[model samples]
Target: MVFGFLTSRRRAGLRAQPVPPEWRQIAERNLAIFRRLSPADQEELLQHVQVFVAEKHFEGCGGLELTDEIRITIAAQACLLLLHRETDYYPRLRSILVYPSGYTAHGEHHVEGGIWEEAAEDRLGHTGQRLRALVLAWDSAKHGALDPTDGENLVLHEFAHQLDFEDASTNGTPVLESHAEYLAWGRVMNEEFEALRSAEDAGEPTLIDQYGTENPAEFFAVVTEAFFERPHALRRRHPALYERLASFYRQDPMRFVPIEQERERL
Candidate 1:
């Protein structure tokens, strides 16, 4: 209890402090989505970023050098998920490991008949409940920050895994506010997940990534990327899924687009 109070106080102080000029400049220069946010939302995101940067430990791997630019850029994108929602700054996530670029991860993959094969796969970002850390490739992260409409974002994809783990599991569902919300989330997410799988099996083009078919957990993460980055397309193609995400996130990313551009896209 005492520790919790002290931690809260420290975070309060961090949020109260004015955002540094350099940090603002970094967001403006690197994150196109930041400029699109309303002034109030922008301030809220910065406050969350302040607390997130202060709390999380960041390390550069693969000979990458850590800098404030890298930290703030990543934090801004992650905290975008927390805007207009109650958050604990991803309490289970303690460290962020950044690589200069995509890195190879060696792991075992289940082949068939209770057989597992060792393989190396290139990964841009990764996180797990047990690992208590998120990893990102700086190059991919920067591109995600720069291109807000790409329908792909490494930071959002990985931090979403952290959200999924909040309930002590890596299922598609996160901690919803009420029983009704949970039921709706489960129904909608399951439907969308299956639809994506069927589309993949048919070799049909999909708005959501084919990677989402990997599992429920990956489905949630991939959809989250599309939720923020390709809001118009997702809303048009899968309105129920988009509504569920908007309700959970408490933000309509469609509002972030300028009125003229929104009309053009529509």
Candidate 2:
């Protein structure tokens, strides 16, 4: 089949070329999230990153030009989500569009008196457009990768949206490994979604971003930011949600880090 041939060719590419020194240096310099992976995951992630960079197109917007730093940095952060999982290389994703900073998109929104109006919403990043393009703010993306514990990564957040959209819907649920897992996913996620909604309604603080309360779809994207960036804090705050994410991502990120970095040094 064509799929098998493409996959075989991809494997051949990864084997044919070791990650270039320059790309490796760039990845090492930028990926604090990379340190949060186990050694095996880290190595595998590098391979995936290489494939991703080669496969996806990177285009600049707002007069910002593309460079290796931009490509590798985005590729490194984006591919981390695919680590430890069999993936189709974000089949829906075709290209990345980078803006120098926040960009505006025209859309309808309710303003004064709850009247609908056309407005321009400035965003750090956006996805869900035709051609499966992801638009990111370069500075935001870099700064997010620089601070691993902030629990907000533009790249991770958008890529999470990509994963969720793979099902032809933007629901919070991703495809699980088994039917039972799907049932458990619905139960646990709905319970947590309700809790978050309650917290928001009561004007109480939530460990996850308030944006997550928007809907199940946004909840999945927002928690993905927490799951990878603030694993320890997420575990302390919402143990069940953290457990489900860890189970789904196959990563106990808190345990994978600092130790992995130390081992790399030894």
Candidate 3:
């Protein structure tokens, strides 16, 4: 794909700066999956993180103050989604509002028959509908990074939502490179979506969380978490699902080896 460049690829127009040594240490210390990547991928991720941090505005909420550690950690996770891809740095992203932990919000949703439903929910993260900004829980984001096999990650999930929303909708589909890709996506995703819905209804053991059956948007976000955190499990039990996600993300988390090596490296 002519989508973009990597430092290892050394493609023209890509001038990746060196990742700061201190930030490197912090990433290695806090992010397990990051260390599982090859050094070249690590360098790619670092440069992307630099771009993300430089471009995005991050404001701490709930009296929490921003710091390099928090910014680097979140930036590293967010940029991981952009690794080895052509991106405009989340073009519609305006800012990131992060709380120290899960926060509450009162909102309404569009329901069937054009009715509006009001509800209050506790959320770890949410993407903006107005193309303005996104929200996150720093504690959950940090926890998500520290563990790589939990099948839950706020950053990956939320950023994946951002990817989906580039089209101004959260319908479990992102922009595809081709129409053929779109056909393939619907085939794979719809089949998996129905299967997950059935599993949830039967209360069957599922590699996908029951929450995924809530809707296609939630399915995309939930699977994003599984694809990164529990790659092996997702691959083992849902190979087709894993394949589709790998194709979209343009990277395979399962291909990286020695899951525990990242923890031991420090």
On lDDT, the leading prediction is 1
Mark the regions of model 3 whose C-alpha exceeds 4 Å error after superposition. Answer: 1-15, 109-119, 257-266
Most accurate candidate by TM-score? 1
Collision pairs in model 2: none
lDDT of 2 by residue, 106-200 (tens): 88887768699999999999898254899999999999887777667899999988888777788988767899888888988999899989998
Tens digit per residue, CA lDDT, model 3, 75-98? 899889888877766767989998
Please report, in order, the local distance difference test score of every candidate based on alpha carbons: 0.90, 0.82, 0.81
Query: 225-245 in candidate 1: lDDT tens per residue?
Result: 988888887888899999999
Query: Could you give me the TM-score of model 3 versus the true structure?
Result: 0.87
lDDT of 1: 0.90
Candidates ranked, most accurate by TM-score first = 1, 2, 3
| Lowest lDDT block of 10, candidate 1 | 257-266
Which pairs of residues collide in candidate 3? none
